[model samples]
Target: MGAVMGTALGAVRVVGGRLGLPVDDLAVLKDGSNLLVHLRPAAVVARVGAVTASVRGDVFGHFARADELSRFLAGRGVPVVAPVAAPVREGGWVVALAEHVPHQAERTLDSTTFAALLRELHQELAHFTGDLPARGPLDDIDAVLALLSRPADLVAERDAVAAGWPELPVQALHGDAHPHNVLFTAGGPVWNDFEDAWRGPVGWDVACAADSRLLDRAAVQRAYPAELLDHWIGVRRLLVRCWVAATDRYRAAPPSPSPSP
Candidate 1:
């Protein structure tokens, strides 16, 4: 196993054991930007920011905010994956324990249903009054550019994109509203991963969910102007590229001191 994955697994096992949850059957459910571990024989899943820790300045704070938002959504009858407990700082990793709902990872919802569900989520999110970064993912660009030593071409593109950022009505958003973040459970499609939650233009969320084959672009355009959607879509694309570059550079660098919790 890779060092990051091994460390994440060990941390979850330690945290799970401390909480009196079973660890004998602990298994990794997913390992991507972050690690999702199922603390089995129990319904708890641990979200370990293995890779995210490298880029985010406050990994614990990030997960804590997500946990808070999930609870809020759950209390309001939103179909969101709520946390089982608060985020725990252990072994230099931030671990969030949440209810592990069984889901069909390969299931795909039709465009109409998908768009409608996303709209429902947005409706609820509008009521959230929590503190969130105003610019959303756009706020991460400077830090990521710094990590990549300010690539000339990317810096120019970022500047151009920043100049076009719209001034529109803002609300809490599922910052990363892609189809993959939706879990198709028997109960229904439950949204997961609020780590990127932010207060920004609703268009930002719309653009995030506008996967060509998964959501009808016309449906999205009806709610927000097509021009605005197109702008946010371009911005989202740029942010994605910046994050990819940052993750690569962060991973390639030598280990650094873990941030204080």
Candidate 2:
């Protein structure tokens, strides 16, 4: 296992022990921007920030907001994975425990269904009155660019994209509303991972949903204004590239020196 995942596993194990949950069979469900470990036999999962903490300065706050939003959405009858407990800061890692919902492994939703579900999510998200950043993931482009030492061409592209950001109607959004984030459960689609939730144009979420090849672009486009969706799609592409570069840089950097005891 990687150092990051190992650290995350250790942290989650410690938290699980405190909560009286079993951890003997702790299995990693996913390991990407964050590390997700299934606290087996307990119907709980731990979302541990890995590379995400390196990029997002307020990782703990993000996890807390996600937990809060998940609870609110669940209460409103939205199909969302509810947090099982409050977020815990342990072993220099932020871990959020959530109900381990079983989902279909191979099933996929059609474009129309996916679009409809996203619309439903947006309709409910509009009612969220919680504080969120006005800018969405695009705002992180600046930080990623800085991590990459601000390449001249990429900097120009970033500035151009920022210049074109439209002043559109804004509401609480599922900031990372992509296909992988939605699970096809026996109970239907359950949305997961709201750490990137922010208050921004609905187009940002629409752009995210449409970017996936698993969905029909035409069907997704029919649900939103083509012009707005197209603009944000381009912006999302840039953000994706920046994040990839940032992740690579982060992985290549040497560990920080230990401070004097």
Candidate 3:
């Protein structure tokens, strides 16, 4: 197993012990930068990751934030995956738990349904009235630049493009508003994964859904400012490029050595 997956399993083992659940019964569901595992004989799901930006680095802030947001949304009757147990943070790893929703991953979602859910989400988020990180895609430009081994010309070009965007009305938005982030269930669409949640232009979310090409762009334009939409579209393209580059670097990195017995 890779280091991350091993760490995830170890964290799950710790959490499972505390909950009196069998670690052997746990099954891996999804594995990536984050690990999703199903806690069998229980309705909870464990999301293991090192997403925190903290002093001790014992907690994953993004996952922590998601748990908080889930509770907030659930209180207001917004459909979302619910958290069942307190998160476990130990040994420089975090195992956050949440209630799992049964659903199928549809190849495509109805444009009208998707837009309606987004509108509902926007409405609820507007009243969140809580502190959150401001969403500016370029806010991570410095990190992206470093990750891609910054070229002077590319840095200048990216900065220039970023400078041209005019600020628009800002509110708490689902930072990564792509279709995959949304879960369609028998009840309705449940918005999960609030790790990227931030205060940003509403247009950013609209632009994101549109970029997926699964929504009616014309309908989105009618609901949001065209200028903001265009600006975010440009920003999304840059974000995707940086993501691709970073993933390539990560995949090319040397694997950790196994411990000697």
Candidate 4:
């Protein structure tokens, strides 16, 4: 394992052990903004290092708060992946244990199902009365753009969005609801990753789904004006690109400081 993964895994093991959850068979499911690991012999999957102190401001509450959103949605009959246990935050790293959902990682979501799911998600999100950090993509653009070697072009695009923000309608959103964020499980389609849950132009979420090319653009436009959808599409596309670029750069940089004792 590389330095960052090695440190993150070690922290997860320590945190899981303390929480009395299984950690012996920890296997990485993914490593990006956070390290997702499956603890064998236990139905729990742990998410570690997904939230940092600096980024926590941009996040809803903290890592554990995801359960709040999950329960809120699940209680309302939204098919979000369930959280199996409360989160553990220690040593500057937060780990959330949740159900280890089985899914076809290679499956392609049908256009009709994708549309229905998004519509349902937005409807449910509108009713969430719980507390979450009020945020929008514009809130983190500077941090993301800083990671790029040549950010002039992206900077120009960002400024334009800022100038036009006054006229757009705002609502609760699945901040990063790209196609890959939806998992097709035996239980049916379930939305994963609520770290980006925020209040913003609902069009931002629709644009992200559209960019995934899994949903029909015309169908998406039905929920948003064609011009507005097109505008947010460009905004979402650049945001995603910058996010990927930031992740790649962070992973390639020198190892981060070890977790505090």
My TM-score estimates for the predictions, one after another, are 0.92, 0.93, 0.84, 0.87
Best by TM-score: 2
lDDT of 2 at 213: 73
lDDT of 3 by residue, 1-261 (tens): 677567658778888778886677788888654678888867778886632221112235556667777789889998888887766565556778888788878645766567667878988989887777774466555565765579686688688776786667788888788888888788767888887677878878888887776777776666543456777887887877765555555556623322212
Off by over 4 Å in 2: 254-261
Candidate with more favorable, higher TM-score: 2 or 3? 2
In order, what lDDT does every prediction score? 0.81, 0.83, 0.70, 0.71
> Model 2, range 1-261, lDDT digits (tens) per residue?
767557678889999999999988999988777778999889999998766777777778889989989999999999899898888788788888999989986777887788888889989999999999877776688877776778998899888888898988889999998887798987789998999999988888888889987887888878654458888988989888887877786677723312212
- For candidate 1, the TM-score is 0.92
The TM-score between candidate 4 and the true structure equals 0.87
Worst 10 residues of 1 by lDDT: 252-261
lDDT (10s digit) by residue, model 1, range 1-261: 767667678888888889899988888887767889888779899998855777777777779889989999999999899898899888778889999999998896765577677788988988999888877676777768877789999999899988877777788989898788899999989999999999988778778877445777776566544348888888888888988887677567634436435
The residue-by-residue lDDT of candidate 4 on 100-164, one tens digit each, is 88898988576556656787788889987666556457656666775454578889988887787
Relative to the unseen true structure, what is the C-alpha lDDT of residue 197 in candidate 2, on a scale of 0 to 100? 94
| Best model number under lDDT | 2
TM-score of 3: 0.84
True-vs-predicted CA distance for residue 84, candidate 3, Å: 2.4
Give stretches of model 3 more than 4 Å off: 50-59, 152-154, 223-227, 254-261
* Clash list (residue pairs), candidate 4: none
Candidate 4 local distance difference test against the native: 0.71
